[model samples]
Target: MTTSDGEAKGEGIHAWHRQAVNDPNPQTLTATSAGHARRRPDHLAVICEGREVTYAELHRRSNQTAHALLAEGLRRGARVAYLGRESEHYFEIALGCAKSGTVLVPVNWRLTSREVDHILRDSDAEVLFAEREFRPVADRLRPVLPGLRTVIEMDTPGSLADGFLDWRAGHAETDLDPGTGRDDAVVQMYTSGTTGLPKGVVLAHRTYFTLMEHMTRAGLNWYDWHPEDRSMSCFSSLHSAGMGWFMVGFAAGCTNVVMRMFVPEEAVKRVHEDGVTVMQAAPAMLRMLLAEPGATPDAFASLRKMIYGGSAIAPPLLRQCMERLDCDLAQMYAAAESGSVVTCLAPAEHTPDNPRLGSVGLPCPGNEVRIVGRDGEVLPAGRVGQIHARTPALFIEYWHQPEATREALVDGWLCMPDAGYLDDDGYLFVLDRLDDAIIVAGQNIYPAEVEMALAEHPAVAESAVVGVPDQRWGQAVKAAVVFHTDQRATARDLMVFLRGRIADFKIPTQYDFVDDLPRNPTGKVLRRMLRAQA
Candidate 1:
């Protein structure tokens, strides 16, 4: 084991090592609730859909929940899956799993029943927690999955004799320690790979604590958390973007406003009415929120910072958010395997005209980013290649997939699925996913770079680029474009608009006009779907 800087792994203080220094802060995920409860018993910890949960109440409830799990014969490292939207019960169950040393698996509600069954069976989940919305699907799959022993209803009592509240209330509230270690796995999130097969990414307890404490101790204020700040959990907990941000809010002892789902109108209302000071949203979600008629500057006046990631944001939309919201803006670049934010574009560098805006900012303290050529050798600055990251907070392995794990983690560095490069100034420029790159005449062409160029045109709304077989060029660039309702541009017009912005060889030779682009649940363009259509 080694640190990102090639030093001995534990040469410096780490999140787990902080306890040895006599620090009072929490070092593990379970302690987040216990520590905050003792400091501010009555302070609101979670607020969702008119329901409020204080830190003390959350602690006591989570304690009962943990006892209930143990009483159900679930041993440490058992997989407990939750199928539902974000709610107070979801966080309660997460903390309960953390306390009981069980691994929590969150199922995306948008997934098909087959996908859900695959995850449930693959993880060998013993206990399932389902909200009312997904009860039907849960019921259909329960009898089929032999390993699934228990199903706890989230909204109301369904297959189980007692609902989530009744079941949780049946157990005693006395806090119990299961001797969980920082190295123990707490959460297992499934990532759908390029083949559409999902692999569980196993994250340890320290994954959530160590890097955060390191950055905080390093005095990095890219995104600050204050006790008075109210943060919104807008992204799905199934994804790292939502779960990581939620954990961060809890670790900081701030109030977290959880949304059932991201509705542009509802998100806007929450921002104004809930007095949300911090928000982490994807660029596509931000675009929809800004398009709402109610998304006035005053509606966002309460926001202290707007953090966007998950995918690239067009500079035009980025400028719109900065101008309309009138708040500090930040960008995060990371993967679920990385455990925490690897690089961040801080508020100080968010100038509209800054050339570095194309960059994803510098690496966080104690983290390292390097580009590697196909031969596994490091590349110099400004050359695009595979992005490899080394950080204290990283997933231990892909659950039950040793070969895949070996391929991803090489020599203490996690090879990111995406392709990118590091600038001379240490900033990161992410081009596109390696799988999504188009090879034209032995030259690499990134779709995102072309999409960004198209976004600069006033008539272009959104676009997706893919490669089509060409007899002469090996593969030629083709674009599926959607224009703004009030704007229109010819294919020649777009070709001319992108003439100087990008290379002539990278420009799309053929274009297909469409109403909109297809995207997945997290607002990422479905390039594979576009490729098949092409």
Candidate 2:
């Protein structure tokens, strides 16, 4: 059954999620910056250390960058890749790629040259941009990247450089609007390949801008930017939140104080010094900041909001932050495929006694978050099932992977295979990645639940759980834990502590106490690696 407006709606769907899914105002992503540039030309748009670029100046520079790309014999939809941290040059070139109708591919800087070569060759990127820090690797990749015609090195502040500024300087600062539409491809980001080779996820202008429009139309205040808002752009540009949030800020003509990369102390200093009003962090970064000696309520007094995701926030740490930072807490849930707002645990829902504290929260405007049973029927509240979502903020398609895209994007919904459920009040509690779920003797076990339980213990620093072959049970749960410095614990002690926290069958059958678990650039544990070890 569908809603009157034709959105998929029925018994299991929440009324709170109905409006966003049913009717949405979609806009091209480029409009976010272009509109502000033409309207508020003098407003500050990007600030990276000593450099500050206004909307008017940024518009002109990016226009020149577009002209340079087109002059280099590139055509619409041609690939241009960036391998570095975020900066003024990064944003101008990225936005410029959109204006010229080319796709901007953000290659993870942390990847080895070989892995970097794979993305460059796979994306068929004609032009490459690099910071001085990556010159050695980027230089090594030229031979393998036959299609790469130009390698422009950007001179980052307080870092080492080359012809990027001069290259962008050579072209005329003239508008080159290629008339790219809302659905046309703009950004291509490679996922952190846990199991095999990374796949590029193609995102369009509408995927970034239309969602913001819909949220604004729905009167979501988080979507609205304040007059003097200054956002800390610390997340790497390679991830969804990295570029997505910057685009959102640009659309609102908000000032973004860019950080080349995340340093716990430096991040805190930027907030206090820059008078930042808004910020986003992964739980890992948040933890480090909270532990930093300089971190205090006064240091974060300027902050009005703190957005976090990429993993579940521990209740203990959540309580400390709520009391100390004294700002609204918004735990967001998103994916590279679905873009950022699958759900958000809004500030109002962060009350101390809220049972749904760990939930990813309700859907953002213009999106629907629903749980579905194995039979493909939508499940009612509190029923555990696959968490599927439908939003305009979805990728255009997976680059060169048709079958995978077809299976994932089913029937107007981007069905993320995350096992979760919505409460009666519409809060989403994410259990585990369906691919990561362990089947032991035909009974299902989620590793995240077990890991969370283990995290509650004082001695446990972090952990990664995986399923391994077991003759008796077909598959057995195993955990690789990282204990805190100067803390002590045994596998037996961890097992004992987890006794009442989770099902006995869900407990790890084997434990490997290690220094640390393998993680991607985004801080997601590499469970597949742990399985390989087992």
Candidate 3:
């Protein structure tokens, strides 16, 4: 396949030329299964905890799962909550729910029982497919969720709870009637917001397939993937990247090596032993793997691609990963609202010689990106502003939040509240979250910019910047820093160093040195935590 320059030409300027431009009908399990069968029937589709499931077997099990749900009187459009660690069965159940026209709500396994209960109640889930490991927490909340009618234990027949349904017994060797088309909602992903509550992001079959097609066009070779190509994902399927990337692998008929929990040593060992060719992880995971004692390049020799995203990658770390890992490195930039990948830094750009070292690459073939000021005026190249995008894969709306949806969607474009700039060559450089912007003595200071500068210091391992209350400046820049190998630096030293690199006003006024910074599982810094500490 040849790469396009991604330039607009005449009337076709708005269309994504490289992406799978045709709209696929809402993808039911049957369609996905058929696609798999036609592509590679005998190929391995999933491998969880050393157990393998072929594409044909995956289809059969999904069919049975759908039939079982139907036999249990699960009406069309009913919300079914799936709570568990990443497993082979998770994908099957999710696809089954989609085929049955039921919304699959996969809750984050790391979430506390209270968070779990809130999602279940908020989504109005009728039944829950829960893992035995979390049975205690589920049981504690079962009585509180009035909308929850039943619980299905995902364990062996004899291990299930007394009143709960056993998933093994529910599986019927029968095909289910595939329902609906591309516009139907398949998954409702809950993402925590700045306001402290989580909101459900509704993704339909059309949007999901649109993203998949976009990935394929961007050089994800589904046909080239082999049944024995061991793929591993440590990110929870509850997140957009986790679910979306896993789906892409499944659609390609690659074997998915599941990690119930993320352990750096275990992940490294899995790659070497399983012949893992594809791996998706956050920068924190990369940092952990790199930090492992005696870790060598050969540890990841089997990997063909190492996908890192969810947060900005420090330049030093990126360089280390390129030098240490014997594989291609791709950077994905996306959001839950965008379904999945919107922009990607190809493997070629991962080299140290590449000029666009800090950029997140050009806009996806079919997607149009622009930097706009607060007044919605488009900024010229190299000017920092809010990033806005228009794509067919954009989310329909924030679930049950019409006003918020209206605020986000303007003239068919999603106004992402991320501060960034596009270079002359169209490469995007994200500065920071708009909400985390700090105003110091009337000048705007983006935390990411400062953190990036701080990361350049040899002593700094990680850093997070926040605006804290101040009497004189109204708000002052405060940095929370984690150092490498017990290396220490004074706040005055950092401020002095930053003063030479940036504006004097943008230099951090205070510093709190620590062992680690608070972050989400995806490696995204939680600025709220720093603000709370302040």
Candidate 4:
């Protein structure tokens, strides 16, 4: 009943399965999904925007997409950037790239041309799959991304050159053995940088199933998906939840209800119409779904389990959601660099009378997470410190940034800036302030990155950004600035200027004009004091 470290077991849920998690030869997800297609070819594998795509169709089309890419001269481990929302085409392209030994980089469609250019250039992605709506931004990026010669538009109104279906139709199903190894990179997710630019976290294909398989061997029920389960994925495809959960569901041979964009009313309606049993939703989305007109407890009665995390949920809201949905609530805590869900708050501990509801449950099977102090020593229970997680799911490296990778990943552990504490019961409490990184709608917005964007305006002397609690987005970004004495700038003007530099979610929703910013004796800005004032 203990981990390899000899720590007492949290849920003791490991005895449910008697098999092993790791394999002698691990490989890309294409193998797993392909097996399902062979075993159950006629099964409904994907349902998106009133269309149902079967497993056989998905596998065949992905093979074609892979062939299309190989014809364009993409080699093993070439990066392919996808700039669009959730769709069958997105999933097809992802699996196709994996089959071809190419890495898939899903870019946030909300980002500006500058942000998109930074990611494409940083990852050196040779091909881009963009939707028609983002064609203008793609056009702007083509001048900057010199190596990016291939652009396949999904859902386009124009000719064959600008659309994906036309491009994919020209190629046959590629049965070529790409000979991809387990350690090969498959996806590169960009984390908003603490420095001026974002850093791409390179993850191998094994990450999608490693933690879940380990949890399965350990007897955990919530870490996996069932073949009969209808899973709804409404989160932004750019985030780990969107693509990560989809791949998990696909591996399980489940029918996934994919949302092109998360419109709260439409999401709830789909859950009801599709008989969605499992879902990966954010707290904000859940709250909105519960508040929609004619939304009753019965509307969500079919849901068997709901997995949510990212931002901290208010106790009353969490309790309300569990009661309204009439389903077991599972909370998972993880980040892009960590690769997969490291800690899972099981459904059994979510009762109103349980004190453990405040915590993010126990660490999941096969991951090592410890709270370390300033002296690099592990802190005891109930003591808050930065969390260091050592897992097989950890990103291979921050793409091309050796110094940053070395700085973040030491030895085998990803030493995260997120601060929290584990109680004697092994329950982890992830604080709202995840190391000055403001999470707005599950998107990570680092204050340092936002402050740098604000300082770009000539009228601003200095700026500080902080996360203020918001009901809708969980946390909203706010700015406090000391303007240049001779210059004039309104809050709106600064925000307008910043909107051009950073993503909209990173831009401050509110601003405060201050004559001076508080500082310590060493002259470092006292963010804690600023937080206290806010």
Cα lDDT, model 4, residue 190: 78
Every candidate's lDDT? 0.85, 0.80, 0.76, 0.77
TM-score of 2: 0.91
Each candidate's number of clashing pairs is: 0, 1, 3, 1
| Estimated TM-score for each candidate | 0.94, 0.91, 0.90, 0.79
How well is each residue in 378-429 modelled by candidate 3, as lDDT tens digits? Answer: 9999899999988877787777788988988899888876899999989999
Clashing pairs in 1: none
* Model 2 stretches astray by more than 4 angstroms: 1-26, 156-162
Worst 10 residues of 2 by lDDT: 1-10
Error at 443, model 3, angstroms: 0.9
Point out where model 1 deviates above 4 Å: 1-26, 157-162, 192-194
Clash pairs of candidate 4? 14-218
Which predicted model would earn the best TM-score? 1
Q: Candidate 4 at residue 473, lDDT? A: 93
| Candidate 2 pairs with clashing backbones | 20-366
Model 4, runs deviating above 4 Å: 1-24, 158-162, 192-196, 437-534
- Cα deviation at 134, candidate 2, in Å, is 2.8
Q: How many collisions between residues are there in candidate 4?
A: 1
